[model samples]
Target chain A: MVWALALASLALVSPARQAGVMRGGAAAPSFVNAAVARAPRDGAPRVHMASCAKLTEAAALLDSVDVFIFDCDGVIWKGDSLIEGVPAVLDMLRKAGKRIFFVTNNSTKSRKGYVGKFTSLGLSVEPEEIFSSSFAAAAYMEQIKFKASGKKVYVVGEVGIQEELDLIGVPHIGGPADAGAQIELKNGGMVHHDPDVGAVIVGFDRYINYYKIQYAQLCINENPGCLFVATNLDAVTHLTDAQEWAGNGAMVGAIKGCTKREPVLVGKPSPLMIDYIVDKYKIASRNRICMVGDRLDTDILFGRDNGLRTCLTLSGVTTEAKLLSQENQIAPDYYVGSIAEFAGAGVKA
Target chain B: MVWALALASLALVSPARQAGVMRGGAAAPSFVNAAVARAPRDGAPRVHMASCAKLTEAAALLDSVDVFIFDCDGVIWKGDSLIEGVPAVLDMLRKAGKRIFFVTNNSTKSRKGYVGKFTSLGLSVEPEEIFSSSFAAAAYMEQIKFKASGKKVYVVGEVGIQEELDLIGVPHIGGPADAGAQIELKNGGMVHHDPDVGAVIVGFDRYINYYKIQYAQLCINENPGCLFVATNLDAVTHLTDAQEWAGNGAMVGAIKGCTKREPVLVGKPSPLMIDYIVDKYKIASRNRICMVGDRLDTDILFGRDNGLRTCLTLSGVTTEAKLLSQENQIAPDYYVGSIAEFAGAGVKA
Candidate 1:
């Protein structure tokens, strides 16, 4: 009986049904009108405006979406502890036949690693349902035919980037192994650049040191046609809920400063991950997809720039004042107190 | 007899004598006319043009200077081996009674350490005559009355910064000790920042690691009114004469990325070092001081920006093609094949 009810809910939120409701504005839900009224029209100058979807309009907003993409950190959980009602809301979305994807700019984890994290958090997730920045980096390299170049990639990151590159059959060097490496300047030691290194990928690395930075810069600045790639440029990352630590941007900036060159960003707000998802999953319509995240710059801007509906959650890095601040140029289409508001219970706010 | 000849040479190149020559343009040496003709006039559009001081005119150029400031690394020596004729040039300059100061942006060594390098290189140098960036950082802190606040500084650099701070009686922490420190994310490790830190100094450090980057960023971002100071932002440095390695800019860039803050630069291209030198040594005139270096951006730009005569040498990181390129905006007053040409021997070029 539960399966039957789930099937019925799935049919009700089908992509075709959602597309029909979107095109026929007269038949659209009240929340659609509320969101569309504040959103900029096509070809119009984009203004930062978002509607606070009330408890009564929450169901209507969720009913209008056929696909849902979520940012893992801050949205799903803060560090190791999962946010309240996350499991229930995820289960509810699954039952409603909403296609879900876990997208994260945290390049410290691979898709398989994310699956493990999700499982440990008491949420069921498959590797295919997750798209980490590390995976995006690998996918980008694959798209560029880097594997055919027969040259190894110089990594200034962690094991996650190495694993992703290994998955794609692209050889790499200089990751966590360089954590203890020292440049004996007292003994007149020098870092030698490998001629076979064709690319350097930077990510959040706890083991980042001067040696890795020197190697990455040497490859990027000296090697011919060497590509400099960054998994993400997040200013700070949540190692734990207690404090924010230096993010991948710190590592990438070191190389950027030395090389005086910018890297090819392949994380959120770049449109590369969404493009990869669209091609791989055959996503029908962008209008029927909703991107739920915590950050305005990375998550909300990522969705808005990719023509997807965006919902901002206040349970993460952003606060209510920050969301409503005039300095915030990128606004979402709708906002809720948290993703916990979608638990089907009465809205907490 | 040597003292009498030195006194005579000193009177011949006195400030007043050089000033008279400058005012009496028609009677000035040929090299002076050559330099003035190519140099941009006082209110004219500045163009990148530098005349190669011929072998015949080297003596006249040397005689026109009351004070000589030399950059150590590429201008004086490559690594351990001193450049040919460096000692002879120093002897000749001293015999000519010119005030000489060894100004270096390499923050890896303190003034005392520089004296040791000079002694080992078979050159006579006093600690008071050397103005390293490390000393400049300490001087800057002293000028800002940082010690009165009773707050300690957090260092993300080598022992040079520490030694200078020690010389100034300022408290500091986190240098080579943090090099072995690791952030064990798997064990849920966190970096605890000290609350007593009022400033963070970044410089060229072979021991630079993510722990230092994180601690520095936390102090700069979370601590109120904390200062971010950089010894230098040199893109690259000569660990040896063979190749260029990452400089302090790489370490500074990491903290800047995470904190999103600009550092108070105390090294070359910043007037802090020259200002400290002027205040301490009481330099009479900027025009009578010749700043000799190899790099156009840091050394030449530093001299030019400070109203001192600039001379570029070709023995360091910069090539003649780079100096003459259309994109090069900062030009020296004169160019030479190398500092070796100033040895009073015939110019090799």
Candidate 2:
């Protein structure tokens, strides 16, 4: 009964049903390119939002999906604390035979750390159940069989990236050192660099400055063969409803400008993060998967690009006006005010 | 006379004099455009270096100019210390009726501060004798009569820019605060903003961080009419032979990426800095002025752009190989091993 209700929620919004766009199976196209994602796909408008405000409308969409992917910062939690009713809604999803995974562009945390946070918040989580940009970067390096055996990693980020690298036995430098160990410049002098640094990884670095970036250039600019990788390309991090923070993209962009090159960004919308998840956890069907988040381009667009359904939550970012905006090309299959809307309302007994 | 010998130096390298290109008078062109600077102007090859290395050859080139504009960092001093034989050469120029003005893109010091430095380096300089990028920015603001009455300037630079603003009584905020007074980010939280921040000036700040850049975005992005200005676009600040520090351009570029705008750059290669000088000094003939420096693009290209004859010295950033390289579109009228070569060694007593 609950499955039928969930199908109704999805049917209320999905353009796939209207235009017969859900050409599932082997015929489902691979990732859509930028040009295709810009305009409507399969004769459907490029963007859409759920029409019903009732919990049952959104719950029907949730019940149809077997796996749920979430963006952390603006969706599940505000900052260090968990969002209200998020745990209960997640618990209900789990009881209904759903696979849950947390995908974040916040390159500041490792997957293990995210799992720990989930456990602390009274939600069950396995290490594989969370995918962070940091881990995505780590996994990417592993997949490529990165030849950083003897060379050190020059990091322009926090400790989260370092932890992931260490797990894979990668040596890194230039991250957050002990307190008061900040490098001082003599007027306009360059920082001393290590000759063995073969790769440069940039994430969310709070202490980013002239010396760190100059050192990164010394590695990449000096050596043309060096690897230039960044965790995410988020423009800004929405902290709360009224406040925002500069994301890892700013630091990454600065270095890119200095070196006159672009980095391989390993976050949402890249397909690298989601690709790693799908390859590891074999889901039943692509249409039965959903990504829920508070942003458009990174979350909903990422879902649309990868042939997965998406739900937009208004509890954090992407206000209703923004969702309905004509300027937005990113669209989702279902919508809810918060995950709290799904708690104890439409789930089966 | 020294004038005849100096003309000989110009005769040695002057495509202008050789090819009858010295078509001076009111008929000479105004400022050269960016595309013109990128390629050879007036059927001239893209790049030319001064041929004579002897002091007599350099002095011959020097004698043709009355006002000589010198770039300080590489042309005069290596860092805090003066280049070998610089003070004596400057003195010789002053005695030869040459109006010696030190024009530095180093936004690290104000004009008065430069005077102190010149005095300490055994070279006498009045405040009018030195034109720094800091003073140029201040002068430009004054020219526009920035109506910042009861408004504060958001400074994302060091003391040099602040000092110039203070001299003009333009109240500013966000420079070197007390030591250990760095602002920390609470995830995506916002910093309190000033209601009266009318402009944002960017320079090299050692203490730049997330909070600082975010605060900058708030001022520029939130206020559509705010002025965004930068000192220079130098990719790296030359400190020593093998070292370089990050320049103001990196900081400016980040804010540009965030706000999707460009800042009005007020340094070398930008006619604004030199325009202020030409207007203030009221020089008679454009051909009577010679811009002398160590770098090609910033100093030599700057000279070419402003209709001034240019000279290059090998005391700093541009190596002889780089100067002679065909990749360079910037050409100079004369070149020497050092400005010291133009002292009494080659000039008439």
Candidate 3:
């Protein structure tokens, strides 16, 4: 049950209004129509527009601004296309001198992929301004000063984690067969005695096998404090069509439960991740910054704790079905149809 | 580590003097000293006593008292041996006509075990007056109408769970290897499959095996709504001796992580568990309850959420080490050496 049900009541609107809004011609009716479509279904609980109103209220509460964060996939576009007038709205925000940073929990792709996404969406985004949990994991390794000199690191991730470690001059220890390599879980690996390996890094690896989980557990158990790092708390991964599948979060959750230790979550909600972003952007004040994401638990909670305004768009991750069931547990301040909805003139105030 | 350090500090004093004061008596000193000796040596930030003081102040601010709750184990004794003055304390409370109930998260042991312990300690206690997570799990299963009849139920627990199921008249399916019988995961089977089994019941099975886990997963995975139950959530269990080990909480946690479905928690701290206790005993009111336990995470959290005043004793699971750890999240209203210390007459309110 996506927020699409919210538009049920507004379904009575004239086809002209729906078309106008869909075409990005009218701002107010466009948002209203989208909200109506995304609201809860009839006979079910009506949509709580408090989240939509929360964004406005939260923005008003802020006295100053620092880093304006944007979650790419849901907020900017669905896939290959931009959401209505998102490009123009982003341009307007940039012209208004708002410092924006693209923040994503996705670790499968590197900065290059994010840059490519911006190019495809017709939004001007710099690679340097993009932050991924993969980057955070790499930064954590560096912060802790793990031995990375020609150290073989195993990878259970896509190019994102591999690239980050590469950029930092960490050698990729391919598999258990690569005897001298540092074992990276989430990739393919088996049990072996490698005294040369300094740490086992966990990242978003799509090709996760049972052997990887078993070997990873063995490594962590054998060498206590072998630097077990996780890319994000994303239990599920985003599909190309916007669906979610099991990801690193699920795998890490298994290990954490088994070990009875919460992983050093190096993702969107962790203070460490936010600190990295703030430091990278040199953001002095966090008062006016707004965090935009589809996840209420991680994104909204992060914003709420960090004193940043939060905007929850119904474009990804959480659906109305999830919201209705978990209303008390996971809640964001604001709701928006899409990033494009913010293009309206009233969005400024 | 354990409140033992504090107890040791006061151990040199006379027992009569100890009975006269709230803490710092000979008995209190011994209890605290024992705890300290058993606790980890590494110094960590302890939970501020001020928070406990604040909770006490909060209770003091309350206008009335209706019920009094008590925690088992450390508050009473370590296993069969009664804490120094627990018997006298209960007698006094009983004589005063104050309502009292034993609250414990020890799902490994049954209500009968607890009743027998009290009798051995020379204190009179009714089965109805005692509440354990094991009993709670059984009652919950019954309330939920878990196996009407001829239901081949898998039992992975001790005699308590078996007794509950038997009393409910639910036919027990033999072990996984037995024809038409589903071996309970807690008993010794990890993963088993039998077409005839109707449901899987999880309780505290000390000898949980890999096959049991795997079989439970298979049974649950095969049937989406197949009942998965847990006795309680005391992450770790404190033995009669000083050492602590992983309890049913960890096993439940494993199953939950694998299934992605939350288990129905039957044990203490659950509202349903609390209700079962209340109904069985027909407690008049809930106002004057004071719950005493060694752990704030389990017992104290239970008391806090359930409108009961909580006291933390330093004889079991929680040691001074945890108190010193900055990461330990929960706190209690009062910190005493033991129930014997609380039973003493001269402690200032």
Candidate 4:
């Protein structure tokens, strides 16, 4: 029934329908066994942050969430290094007996790379606890049973995607190596593509070239039942507090424009990440889980869309004014100036 | 008035208006200060290919086109080698005292590179007779007087774009060199953007990385009234009869998606190419010129939009069924099984 519905959604070329499935939202994210499970509350509450009363209310809300899902790049680290006060807050949270997961949309780093980074940052994180877009993408493929089933995957990313695919035992082609080492591109020449490729997975690739784009396009256009999947369609990546960089969306947009097809984004806001977490961990009650994130669209939307209680930390991307004025904006149940504030507001430092 | 119109169009946020100015079409391609000139006919009759009678009709129609505009790929050559009957046909047409122009949307090759290719193909052609999107892009920048005017161009393309910019004396940054050689993109660490940079020109960059896209986005976002220009938005490049590569549209689409702004495309179907041709050559009567190409949208649309006759050649991209069925499709004045077929039908071979 789900497969049939998915196929049906792909056929609707209307703009309204484009939002339903192409975004990885059509599938039920976390209601594992039953459709009758109550859906998560939408637009929960506005935790005004002007007074001590609101601060206590926000802390109480954070205290209730059994599992705390934190976003990486903006929340815990900036670029390759750890953010200040993040490690301390994380230690405090762990000591308070809360289950923690680091969810990030940055697909450039692999799980192994992330494991090393976590150790360096003085945080005890399990490989399973880190759910990056790269891993989620691989997990998604596995969920759909697209791993080494007489089909190869075409990658448009860096080492992260390759590492995840290797772990899943899925053979892949067309990535950074061929793109970066390319010396000459003849206007009209012998163009080659792997015919066995059945899926094109796009992530945050630094060496995103025309050759890769062409190869990916060929794989999708030539192959039947080829899946066009992207890690995340993030509009921008705040590499630091002062700078914004082009995210995976830029790379995906190029392929999207060329193929005139939408990709199944497997990152935050897609509900796919939460699905991966819930399915793997078998969370007893999802209602107790709270998602703490930096950005509204990816982190907050992921939490909201996946039926988890949401909290927005001003420590990252969202400003209070921008978060408040937008219509139908995903309102978090709690808001704090920073996650660092959590240490002082009733939580043991 | 032009700036007001440009701003108004930008505000419309409608797809139709996106074509008006963002594509460099708002500024007239070339009009020699004459409002009394006769416009070319639209939706003109196509020469039938049913029988010997239709063959003669096609031959007669070809006889009327004094100036022939030929699209390079698929028309003159299939890939790197020349197409079967193009050279002989060109020779015959030249002997018949016809003015010819080779126009292409491939921005990867410069006019000199095109000249070398033409020479190698045994065609005696002048550098000025060849009008590529690369040349047109440079000319457009030159027309706008970007060089030495306290402004620089940030290119998202390869050697062709650099060569053209070099010829026009336009100092450009963010091309192939800086991108392919980039290591460890330190997010938000001393990003050096030329403050005088006023235009971001996107062409076919095979080394299209996240770094380049980010720089291009920053150039446009940071600089006021920076021109967002693209060579062509051709969906696919026919590398050979059997293979298709991702075109400039993919690269341009990335920047457009990231920047959330439109680009001024100076290639076919945008009418800017023909405008450049008309203005530079100072054609007394546009009715005598004919645009011959394989694609309907780019080639036929270019001719139709610029008030010139158009012909479709089956040797390259379009199929008859697709050309006919598309709603409000750009129709041509003549159709042949191939440009080679024209030589066999009635024209000298």
Candidate 5:
């Protein structure tokens, strides 16, 4: 039952609420008050909810926004396959002079890696138009002027985080290289810690091992002024459409258990990525930006918590029945069968 | 702060209280009420606590016990080297006609493995006198008639567990073999699970990796009636005198994070080990049994929760300062600088 409550809070609660409940000492972002004020609280009437599948409604939704932030996995594609009509819808939005940005919580790939993915999916995208959680983590360190601290980062993630840190010229250790490490109990389980590790960044790591978990915990728990950062806490992730694999949350949980510390989440619903986007791109108005995605928890919650209008598409994890369930706390502004409806709306118009 | 509270509870709280707090649905063992009735409650004056280092008190303690249960790692030895006067203390206890049993929460080694270590330390001990958590796990399975269910076990531990399971003729899979297994995201992160795995057993593992964690989670979360069992939840363990390594709790935490399930603990303070020991050995009258150890949480709490007299040593993880701290909740009936004090007491006599 506690797990259920945790899951519910993770999936439906706003980032501010999550910050208060999960990360005890984290301060809510400045933009949270405005977003909280605009969204309907639990037990409130659902009068603002609408279906944007119809041509008139969809076109009205499209016309209201100058910028569109899309979640990649479920919105534009699932796994390696592109979603139907996504490219056409993107072209139409571009023709209408709408700026587009691909925002993803997937930290397994960097911005350049995502460019390769986008190109392979037949979508033209620039590195600047992508904001992965890996990029957010790197940008956060730069924002805090971490390089001047004269301490390195201890990574418990994959190549994406390593590449992003490399891009920013931030020194780090212990990622894929530590995957094959084995604790030799015969020689005595004396694990050495690097005292210069001032921060630990955890993300989705397929090669996660006990050595990395122990090393990261040592840095976070023992190093002075050390930071614990999580790229995302998504409980499960889609590496393929076949099934959900254990997400980075599992990796983070291991260290959290050992160190007994809460990580500063830099992924979706944390406002870190969106704030970075807003400051970097100098986005004029939050009211003119719309977030389109297929997940109620990460994508929709991220949008709602950052003062952006949100549209829920049923092409990925969430479904219409789930959205309409009595216990559902999150209410998206608009719902469609898929993002393909946008192309249909253009054609009808 | 929560971790501190959890640690305090783990080390000091009686099993009944731990059951009520941590394992919500489980019922306290029949011996719990008597144990709770005998121990001093928090906020009460610890009047029964005594220093057994004096010859008078030590001789009185030695005179009252019919059986002695000693915690291995911290009590008899730390890693490899035996503590000073341990052999003489054991010889004295044996000559006094006191039955001795070596009870350990270290699931990394089975009873047979312990015999070799004891012999190497120049102490003669029979396998029947050892009660490792690995043996308790196997015994528990037999007690519950798990074999009749025609289901195999999935192990997330080392060879100790495997050896114990083999002794019981229980079929199992996934241990050292799964250590090197990698998740091939290139082939789609679709991990197949064996439908026959009806239980998962976790313990301190050096070669812990993502594949074992993911597989165990799948079995516990998806498979029908799949049981999750943990050998122990010790936060930190000593492999040598150098420093503490992350214990089995970290390994269990990874799976717990993903599965959101509580495990049936089979180690110290769980009553499972003591219950099995009592049942198999036909030990009568718990009143005369003395539990001697260096740790307060597992060893002393195990004794207190099982209605046995408890003695704490300052030779391992716990110190006298901690025992006398204002925040201390659990109180052992007797305290000593080390078991070597027993030898001093004998010499004085």
Candidate 6:
């Protein structure tokens, strides 16, 4: 079978596998909470149940789990600051000697920035405790042994990516003038005007205009073998003012959705991030680990896809309404109104 | 039976005794055209082939079909005055004694503005030929006998909606504060502020800020019995710069999507417009009517849902890729490269 069950916590797995947990009861630890099927209505899309009890039950099963994974945006904070009681919850977790990690798919900020943010927000967090998609992307380039000593790779993202590439000593170029650099490279021809582009790496470039999208598409099309990497796969970025703007995820999706080729993801729930966290921390049994997040598509999905206990908070992206509607999607092992509730009540094993 | 085949057409008609026509066999004098299903695809949404094919073929069936319905924004000119041979096609149709009816769900522009736009585009059209959501909404108020004689009916749309209420002699209040003389009423007691508002009329408001949406929601929540009317149901609006902007449909959907109450639609394919057109023009039979448009959900669906022919054009919103993917949602009767092709090739009937 193309699908197989992993005998571990649902929180540490991939997003796709995490959504598949509602199938067999015998495979799981126990069927503590199950969503009920709703009756169909006339002229309305059929909706399925996503119960809060299911998340609570999952939390109960992974009481003393070791590792803790957290998503930054929509989980802890919308952008810049932390949600209510986030600092206190983290302090309690640290006091309890629980191993905590900040696993974010956002490729914009560097680890130092994340550490700075946490410190500024009155939370004790170190640079080593943070893991971003930019780090994973740079590592992928290193693993592939990509040659970029003299040639440039078009950078399309933020400071985190630039920092990662700088750490790896990789040279990259970007701009409207450098747009035709890829086509020039294909014909064994070096660009006479600005000839130094070897590959194209698409990241979250906030100041995106029409010329940028067109140039990026052209560059990628010209050089088929050129490296193309997308930092993360988030369609919309939630902000504080309830203003939702389309993120790089949608652009990446438009490009990858149009083109059938899957880009190598390097963020949380990609198995890459989980593996990095597990191996680096030397966390011995994967079953002892638990991942807490607010978004189902990213956080709970990351846990379920991996082998960690997944706890979903109602304070973020997927609300009670969204959860109640999502039937077969990622079901969290524990459902808490806020992270503070989990820390205070202590998940019972 | 709930679903049975008609003996004359062998077409599957619902138990409601909806009007249907016979397919190919004996050529009846009244027969305009026949609809057939396109080849099926795996993992595709299920669209009744007749639904997609009937509208396009309907154009050929009529003997001088009155009121040629054209969906605006996406179907005709999007954003600015940029369209692919639409103006020329309209000119040709007008010369051939076809009464061009600009039927749109867009409640942004007034009839005078639309008439002016046509004149500027070299297409001689009158204000009476335009049928917009505002006009349909006015008709609905009259039909429902909504009594709002001195009471303030909060208008959340453009000047066109205000103009429609003026024509119908409905005492209305509320417009942008910037319009000193036009400001008949202040913000009502809704999320935005205006209290004491009797009803809510949702129109195409481009200057929608957070305050506006909040106000609208607040108003609706305050008055459960307040009437909610949406001019159209378009998901995305295509702009001249090849950009997809949020149309009133999404806003309408957001309000409805957030609130469980569904708004009454006053635009095309709702049977209201078709009835108004037929009654106003005194069209002998519905069989002679054909709906020509670029979008599938609104334009083509109008024909399919109402037992008329629909023609899908590539010049507007629904492209070939969208058509192939949107098989399950809505389908057009005939696929044409552009209106130019449809107009150039005379109706075979």
Instruction: Return whichever of 2 and 6 wins on DockQ.
Output: 2
The sequence of per-residue lDDT tens digits that candidate 4 reaches over residues B200-219 is 88887766776788788778
Q: Indicate the fraction of true inter-chain contacts that candidate 3 also forms.
A: 0.06
Each candidate: RMSD: 10.3, 9.5, 14.2, 11.3, 8.5, 10.8
* Tens-digit lDDT track of model 2 for A1-349: 3233434544564353322234321222331211112233465534322221223344456556788898988888876667888878887887777788889988777877877777776777888888898998888888877744578788888878889999998888888862234555465545677888878998877677766877887888776578889887776775544566666767876777667678988888888977777877876566777888888778876776676777788877578877655455444655678878767544543
DockQ of each: 0.37, 0.25, 0.04, 0.33, 0.40, 0.03
Q: By summed lDDT, which 10 consecutive residues of candidate 6 chain B come out lowest?
A: B181-190
Per-model TM-score on C-alpha atoms:
0.85, 0.78, 0.47, 0.76, 0.80, 0.57
Lowest lDDT sum, 10 consecutive residues, model 4 chain A, at: A30-39
Candidate 1 lDDT by residue in tens digits, B211-316: 8888998899888999999998988887876668888889888988888899999999899988877777788788888889988889987886677777888888
What i-RMS does every model get?
2.1, 3.2, 13.8, 2.7, 2.0, 13.1
| Number of backbone clashes in candidate 2 | 4
Best-fitting candidate, measured by DockQ? Answer: 5
TM-score ranking from best candidate downward: 1, 5, 2, 4, 6, 3
Give the alpha carbon lDDT tens digit for every residue of B1-349 in model 6: 1111212222443221133332321233233234444444565444243432322343443344654677766567665654677766676677666666778777866787677766776677778888888888888887776754444567767788888877777766654531222111211211234566656777755443333443455566555567777887665454333444445654464345223357888887588887887788887766556677777777877766666655677777666877755323554545666666545434332
lDDT score, residue A311, model 1? Answer: 85
Name the regions of candidate 5 deviating beyond 4 angstroms.
A1-57, A63-67, A187-189, A279-291, A294-297, A304-312, A318-337, B1-57, B64-66, B187-189, B278-290, B300-309, B319-335, B347-349
For residues A114-159, write the lDDT of model 1, one tens digit per residue. 8889999899998999999999999999999999999999998888
Instruction: Residues A252-330, candidate 5: write the lDDT tens digits.
Output: 8788777768889899989988888788789987767888888788888888778777778888878787876645666
Q: 1 or 4: which has the higher DockQ? A: 1
TM-score of 1: 0.85
Q: lDDT of each structure?
A: 0.79, 0.70, 0.57, 0.71, 0.77, 0.59
What overall lDDT, based on C-alpha atoms, would model 4 receive against the true structure?
0.71
Give the per-residue Cα lDDT of candidate 4 at A338.
Answer: 70
Better of 5 and 6 by lDDT: 5
lDDT of 6 by residue, A1-349 (tens): 1011113333454453444444223344354455545554556555443323544343444355566777777667765556787776676666666788888877777787677777776777888888888777777778777754465667666677778777888876553243222312121322222235555566554443223433444455444565568777764454332433344554453334222345667775678878877887888866667777877877877777676766788766667777655243456656677776655434342
